[model samples]
Target: MGATPATRPTSTPRGLARVGDRVSFLYLERCVVSREDNAITATDDSGVRYIPSATIGVLLLGPGTRVTHQAMSVLGESGAGVVWVGEHGVRYYAGGRALTRSAGLVEAQATAWANRRHRLEVAREMYRLRFPDADPAGMTRRELLGGEGDRVKAAYRAEAARTGVRWVRRTYDPGDFAAGDTPNQAVTAAAQCLYGIAHSVVVALGCSPALGFVHSGHERSFVMDVADLYKVAFGIPAAFDAAAEGPEDIAGRTRRALRERIRAAGLLDRAVADIQHLLAPYRRADEEAAGGKAEDGTDGGVRLQTDRDGTVAGGRNYGAEGVW
Candidate 1:
């Protein structure tokens, strides 16, 4: 009898759709990841082990990890984000695309962001959610920014006092991590960690990380915005605690502590919910308009409508323009 050839798996593992699903972050150093038996396998100095790619939110590739083309393909298909970081996962260099293909949420995000008034409304909504005890209804963009800054300052001071970590000021040079003071470095590391987590969730939810309400310009502006919303609750405390531990292995310590805090607070699901809530007003408005039109017997076949500037009105025309 002739020898049989090895065959690839017919299907890849499906990623999590809902935010409540259990997803984990895998950090590997000096390892090679490859596809084996329909699962992602990582080979390091120890041995080879399977990685549940579908349930992974982000794969943090630090230092000497080599990823095969097949492994990358599987991860891409599974909607898992691959982030390249520096030693100890302190610096984020690049990332892969989100696995979600839904255009409805993306369209709604663009529509809301493209309009100035709607964008302000979304910003206000974010502020309200972040500070539920206070009212941001009458606040302007500048006022909101001021309030947020004050709140963040207070959070840093509070966390410093709680953790017994000295607080002088927040100063850090991203290019040179060592130049910053201990607390600064810890804060930066913690924020970066939160940003990575937030980015994974944002991508998984099928939303644009570029289009942001309070933040703009950067590629991961939306990610920063979302992460900022929860920083007072997670990042600040994690940084302070890590700083209190002294400078020995600060990066690794901060990462581990932040991960524990995130898990304990159910941060992933909260992030997903916050994204949905931030975009909910726009989604609700569209649904209500559609419903109202339907009730008035004006249910014409959906057609592309544009304003004077050629911006898509009543949500994007996904068929003609493609998802933004």
Candidate 2:
């Protein structure tokens, strides 16, 4: 016989903390994840540890990790995204949903993307954030790309000089892990981690990951766009620091350094605010009219769309009114 209601686990995500207030992401491997009431139990040879599902923003499952259905269900209810990555975050396999139930932010994103002038303006704003000292207001897309390339190269050189690590051009082979040097491996690891974090934030805010201002023709273009804004400040330096420490276990060391940097910088909070700011002009005013808060939805409720940019109560017998 099936379990009774009182014995079943709670599936509602009500009263959970906001995603911006949680950890950026948690990386785990070589462990089994199982459900333990509201928290998840990670079991390994070292023993079991309980992690509150609602406190996680993103859970990165690296190679050798196994997760059960019950654990995933609780995570989904808590509005946490789950990303499956290769060892050292070399490749991304799949991703899960974020914490939002409303479509306000995505509508805003689509509106801005469909307009040429607004799209370019958003792209310029992104570049401005990347290079706070420069003005990208009047620059074209090509100009922005050129400037970004130059700045990135300069950042690489600066980090190498500061860390006393010999650096060359970035290189990576998807099939072969040892083709690149220690620095390249570290950089790749850092970039992948940043991508996971950005993906989680974008989805958490109900934004489309494919709608990008700077990048195009990729599924994760928007993720790339958002992650690049902090490459100079977070990813590169962390990678270089890990490489400087030692070449042994560069990927592990890089992840540790990057995690610390992300926490110290309060990256989750900053990312949430920056994204909202960039898409502020396009935010739908009707979001509030739909009976939800602008900052993440209220209770993840469902509503029906109506004509003239309006929303109505869902789960009704409207078919009798000829409005089916």
* Full-model lDDT for every candidate: 0.73, 0.83
- List clashing residue pairs in candidate 2: none
- Candidate number achieving the greatest TM-score relative to the actual structure: 2
Per-residue lDDT of model 2, residues 36-150, tens digit only: 7778889999999999988887888888899998888777767677887775326674355656666767878898999999999999999989899999978998999999999
Give per-residue lDDT, candidate 2, residue 226: 95
Candidate 1, residue 255: Cα displacement in angstroms equals 1.2
RMSD of 1: 6.6
TM-score for model 2? 0.88
List all candidate RMSDs to the true structure: 6.6, 3.4
Model 2, position 9: C-alpha lDDT score: 63
* Residue-level lDDT tens digits of model 1 in 40-143: 89998889999766767778787788988878876665666777767432566435454443344666789899999999999998898888887998789999
What number of backbone clashes does candidate 2 have, counting pairs of residues 3 or more apart or in separate chains?
A: 0
- Please give the lDDT score for candidate 2: 0.83
112 Cα displacement, candidate 1 (Å): 0.9
